[model samples]
Target chain A: MPVSVKNSQVVYDALKELGVGLISALPETWLVHLIRMADDDPDMILVRLAKEEEGVGVSMGAHLAGVKSAMLMQNHGFLASINGIVSGAQLFRIPLLMLISHRGHMGEADPWQTEGGMLTEHVLEALRIPFDHLDHPDTARHKIGEAQTLAHASDRPTALLLCRDLMWEAA
Target chain B: MRRLEALEAIYPRLSDCVVVTIMGAVAAELQSLGHRPGFFYLQHAMGLASSMGLGIALSRPDVPVVVLDGDGSLLMNLGGLTTMARYRPPNLTHLVFDNESLLSVGGFPTATSTGSDLAGVAAAAGIPYSVRVHELPTLTAEFDAALDADELRSIVAKTEAHYEPPAATSGFVTDLGLLENRFQFQRHLASL
Candidate 1:
């Protein structure tokens, strides 16, 4: 089938290895399988968010309860969640690990996503939320682990941009 | 009923649950009674207290989670009600204090002042238990029952749009900084 299915499993396994007991996400195209995986897992608590910003508060709650959690969303979702990221996570010093699908990048076909994709990194930079790219399946696990570790160690928000290179095969 | 009096009425019952309050008047008023490890004044995040309580409740189903929200904050995140209803964790209790205005920030009129019904929205959002209380006694009784119920609950408490300035200063400020409160709250959760 498609490589995204395998890569999604890799990402899901990495999250499990990191002891992510809860994951909050808003549905997105690239994240369908990841959200499905979280939903199917009996041991995982998957929270479906109405807005991506709510994930920040969810992660803060998880942190307060000493439970590891992650937020799965698209680049646009990240853009929508800036207020919570700054006011909630940053202000409260919560470790927020966000897995963002990098849509509208170099080969983006959807015109609607291009502007958000172009601005995603700059916004993350402006917010000072450290981020890394997951462009290859081979390195997905390692990168995810490193990001999670850094997030908790620094007690701040960090992000992983899941690139099209790993998540899709261009038609 | 007055907001502070309402908070005072319910403060005694909060010892067993983790209480998350919105920033501004709610947090300040709660702090005035005293600080506890279980109390997290979600400072600056105006509208996400319900979301935070949902996370805590989902993470620790053994512990009860209460969200003290305001009409202005709740209106800003109406989607939060739908999300909370979607999960409907048994241990989560959402208490919205509808003062009809943003009392902490200059008593600005909110949607509630113009005929918005928070309890109606919450009930329509599918929370199993949703009610509106206009008096302190009803609020206290409903709050106690909500904690005891084995289903998700939401209560919209209508209080006067009155602001009480502290004798010395604005109760809007907390003694502990944001980071310190977070650490202390986390430690307390860990202890339990």
Candidate 2:
């Protein structure tokens, strides 16, 4: 299935407004369009990572060097990066902005993704990482900017969860 | 060769490079040697020293960055090798101290002990320069050459496992916490 370029543009514009200079991501079906947009942008450095934890590491490093960076991945990848996020980003007080695709939500079709969907908010709460759910495309830019502000002010990782409704045109 | 011996030889040659040391003996020993604002001592992020160094190198192109990684830690994130190769940051040099064991966690043998060739893997992953050294002189010479060149380099130094003594308390102050250390390093970079 082809990605919705218009839907991806909403999130991409929000990222640019947030001034994210670098982005590290592990590709997911829902994030294909956004990832492609990031790769083509000359102002942004797009890093394709082998694992989600590496994205955390890269974002932390970029933060240390005064470059604002974000990590884009699925909720499953978010679970994979918990250790790195806690030890590296949280311990060092490095501010990282994460854009996670919210899968397995209420009407999720894939059984494999449902478990991760249900556990996403709980895990974020457990880690004490604040998050904003972007369920509507119109509010994405404002929510992303707010998340960036929170991340920088707290010197911690903050997340913007993109729901399938906001990411897919048909949905 | 022991890890400290290799460190001792290379310590004198370090200039204005930002050094990121992996957790465990590597971090403890580097802390014991000296405290520099340029040194980022990773406490518990086992496999991120190289990744962090890569970020610094990419963002700060004028500054040279070095990563002091252990074989165990490197093996945990072998994928990092490919990531480094892909970007091939000219200002970054990764040195893995291959003691073939997780010395900090009671000396359990790692993959390197079973004939895993990290330098070869790095070469195959597309890093421009990669070498393995087992002697102090060769290690120092190779490191010096890498430092002098403007290219991504990797060195796997075969080292023997040795216990790192705890930081002395009589006259030494305790190291800064992670947040403070990060701020201090950032301050140093800003000043530069």
Candidate 3:
């Protein structure tokens, strides 16, 4: 199924407004549209990563280089990256803005994704990383900007969870 | 080749370059040689030095960024090689000292000891330049060439396993912590 063009536009606008210069993305079925949008943006450098943990490291490195960067992945990828998130980014106090597609949000029909969905907020809580849920495209720009501001000010990783309802165009 | 000797050969040549060292012997040895604000000694993050160096290189294209990684560390994050190659930052140089053992922990042999080729892996991953050096002079030449070239390069140097206790008061464990070191490094970069 093709991702909604409108949702991709909103996310891209938000990323641009946050001054994200580089985006490291791991494969996620739901995020294909956003990744494609990032690749098309002239001002942004989109890097395809082999693993989600690599994105955390790349984002940290980008932060040190004085470039604003983001990591795009799904809930499972976020789980795979916990070690890097804790040991590298958190320990170093490097700010990273993460865009995560919330796969298992309430009412999600995919049984395989429910475990990751249920544990997503818990994991972030354990890491003490604050996150916002994006339930509407209209709020994406403001939410993303706020998330980036918080991440930079706190010098810690922050996240925006993109719910399926928000990503899928209204029926 | 000894890791210290490999470091010594290239230490004097490093100027205004950001160096990220993998934790353990490499970090300790680099610290014993000389502590510079430009150097970031990563502790506890076993396989992240190369990735961090890649980040630094991508962000600061004008600054030369070098990663001193170990065989075990490189093996832990082989995916980092492909990621680094994909970006192909001209100012980045990745050097892995293959002692074939986890020297920091008890000397357990790594995959390299049984015959893993990191330079070959880097070349396969699409890095422009990759070489394996067994002699000090060749290692020195490789370092010099990597610094002089505006292309991504990787060097895997065979090193002897030697255990040297790290200083009790090294920069990594000081009260300053990683956060303080990051700020100091950033301030230094800003000055340059």
Best model number under DockQ:
1
lDDT of 2 at A114: 94
lDDT of 1 by residue, B25-79 (tens): 7777788877788999888877889999999999889998899999999998999
Candidate 2 lDDT, A1-171, residue by residue in tens: 545678789889888887888899889998998899999999888888878898877887788888889899999999999989999999899898999999999768889999899999999999999999998878888889999999999999999898877876663
TM-score of each candidate structure, all chains considered together: 0.97, 0.96, 0.95
Candidate 1 Cα deviation (angstroms), residue B109: 0.9
**How displaced is residue B136 in candidate 2, in Å?**
0.7
The C-alpha lDDT values of all candidates are: 0.90, 0.86, 0.85
How many Å off is the CA of B111 in candidate 1? 0.8
**Model 3 agreement with the true structure over A143-168: per-residue lDDT tens digits:** 99999999999999999998877786
Model 2 regions more than 4 Å off: B166-174
What docking tier does model 2 reach? Answer: medium
Candidate 2 per-residue lDDT, tens place, B5-109, comes to 888888875546788888767766767777788888877877988888888887788888899998988887889889989999998999999999988778899
Error of 3 at A102 (Å): 0.8
State model 3's lDDT.
Answer: 0.85
Candidates, DockQ: 0.87, 0.73, 0.73
lDDT: worst 10-residue window of model 2 chain A: A162-171
